[model samples]
Target: MAYENLNFKKAHMTFDEGYFYMFDDGWDTLLQRLADGGTAFSYPLSDTIDSAVTSLEYDGINFWTLQDPGAGTITIRRWQVENSICWLKNTLNFSTFDSDTFTVEHYHTSLAATASGGTTDIQSASYGTVITSGTVLTLGPNSSSQYEDVTVSSISGTNMVLVSGTQNAYDSGDEINFYNNLWIFNNDGSGSLHKINARTGANITTYSDSEYDNITACTFARVSNVTSSTVDALIYSKATNLKYLNVNTMSLYDTMTMDNLKVNNTTIIVIYDIAIAGNTIYRLQKEAKYYGGDYSWTYYNYVLSTVRRFIDTVSISAYPTILPNNAVNVSEITTIVNDQYGDGVVNKPVSFTDTDSVGFITINPAYTDLFFGTGEAISYYKAGIVVATVTITATATQYD
Candidate 1:
């Protein structure tokens, strides 16, 4: 095997379809072919356009970036790529720029709504906090000719009241784009992380915790391919902190800590940036040591199980289903959980039950194994148990 080492400046990254893109030195855009690691291209943007790009995101159609143009305000621009050339489509000048606001995420909710013509109300679980009165929303961007913009007159419990009425009918699962509702964050040393809904200019939620005091970088991640509650955000603090924040709940779902390799017993690890592709997370890290003031930067990637692979098929193991009525005889009943792709799903909860209380299972809620996704429970039909044939059922719980 052969290898090559190259140096690249720290930059922002995004992925669309099958191609990966990044901005090196905040100015040069590079596209790499993931299949063969060949066919690479680089295009450097002029300083007149924007001095530095703080954040970059691709939403399967256009590339969006937040830039610092040596001015007091921040500029958000959208670009379209044609024949490997990027053409600027639109630009938005935004004030109140903060240094901590260095990441931008293009958000597409897995939610859809249905409404009839002249309907004055829309119901959704997402209108809890951010979708309030006076919030204008653009509905049904699913096609070129099927959309209407409406303003919220008031909020009644969980329903949103429009200022006027719908102009056309909308079906369920239709795109409800609230003006490209992008997800961005602001960490102002308040020990609170504010998730801003760029569409309505309202905050989605504020997660108050000391763990997020030093947050420096974040990116959106996909949890599953399901239509509802599928997106999460990965946040990184300057300290040794990494966590997954559920977008809907505004709470921490999981935390991760990576160990640093010790060379001189004095090493500091810093996670620079993070990006997600499917279930894989790519992280750029810097390790600094006091020995001769040595430091090195490296890129690391890890694969995680995010999609909740349901039980496509369940089968009993080689254990005997028929057991003797003797008290000393024990029947080890095992159930296996397999996904539609015929792969084992680990750590899923499996419960064992019998009909009419004929037998008792030792482990009621056993978890699937890491090896074969199989859970075992001891089923005993002893002397007091009936001799009639009983059915044993195993149920697996889906997890995300």
Candidate 2:
């Protein structure tokens, strides 16, 4: 027969001789029989022997054993021999270790509860201070907790400077350049243009104002240069004629008369309020022969078709001069000339002759000067049309 339920601690301490039985616990049969007094000799039970023999003992009303101590303040160990046995024992006393020097273990489950895609709850059961609403926790320099409040300092620059909680100072020379969205000098008298940053008043760059001919009344209409280092500024003057300024040398480069600027047999008028739109220039002019009175306003759109058309033609021949050697191949020269004029001139043949070892080419070119016809009329108009043409001869210089 099998014993269904047995408590080893409450089993009989005395037993019959010449009989053997197995204790449910792991004690040796001989030790069990000796404890029961089944042997002839009497065996005295020591504290160490009894402690080792009994797996569970009464500590007050609870069944527990005095566990062996570990290195730390609180340690636990669990072991079982057979069946449905489970045991948990604390190996150390909380009152034995020093309170000030004892180490504590912390376990955290969720850290990013406020982050995006976070689902776990942020619990503050282990922390001393609970984090309520609007309280931000920050890490300190040495990994501790800290809180901070930020503030901005002062700002300073060339044209203007600002101090915290103080008045801002503005220099007399500071002015805004509306076209370029930058600050320039109002009247520096130094004949130099200084570009300044608007926000910080810092000096960004400086350019020579001599390109505008030391004339502050002139306005820049456009800038054109095949080569960026050498640019031509198209400037308009209120009192004088239109001038092209050389940016590199800062000098008056070229000039064109108002009469020379013509389109579709109409004398172009200078209008002030018009602005340059892309490759085209639009202007508003007063028509002298308008059906209405002279006070009538008329707007005219002058599309720079010739300017855009001749740009490729001019760039081809002009690009070579800006190059290193001042020389370009025959194909490039042909492309340059063809760009200026259409393909009609490409098929036309030319005759060339060499005289005095100088290369010259001649073509049938003729024109009539209607302004001065013969010696009879100092100022004359040709066939009721004010037009002029002349015969021209040209030569080309070859480079070695």
Q: Judged by lDDT, which candidate is best? A: 1
Off by over 4 Å in 1: 1-8, 24-48, 68-192, 197-210, 224-231, 234-238, 259-266, 286-400
Q: Report lDDT (CA) for all predictions.
A: 0.54, 0.24
Which residue pairs does candidate 1 place in steric collision? none
Error of 1 at 394 (Å): 30
TM per prediction: 0.50, 0.22
> Mind sharing the TM-score for model 1?
0.50
Error of 1 at 350 (Å): 20
Model 2 lDDT tens row, 263-360: 43354434322223233322222322222222222322111222122211111121122222112221112111222222112222222222212211
Each model's total of backbone clashes: 0, 3
Model 1 per-residue lDDT tens digits across residues 225-271: 32235554644544544556666566766554433334554454545
Assess candidate 1 and give its lDDT.
0.54
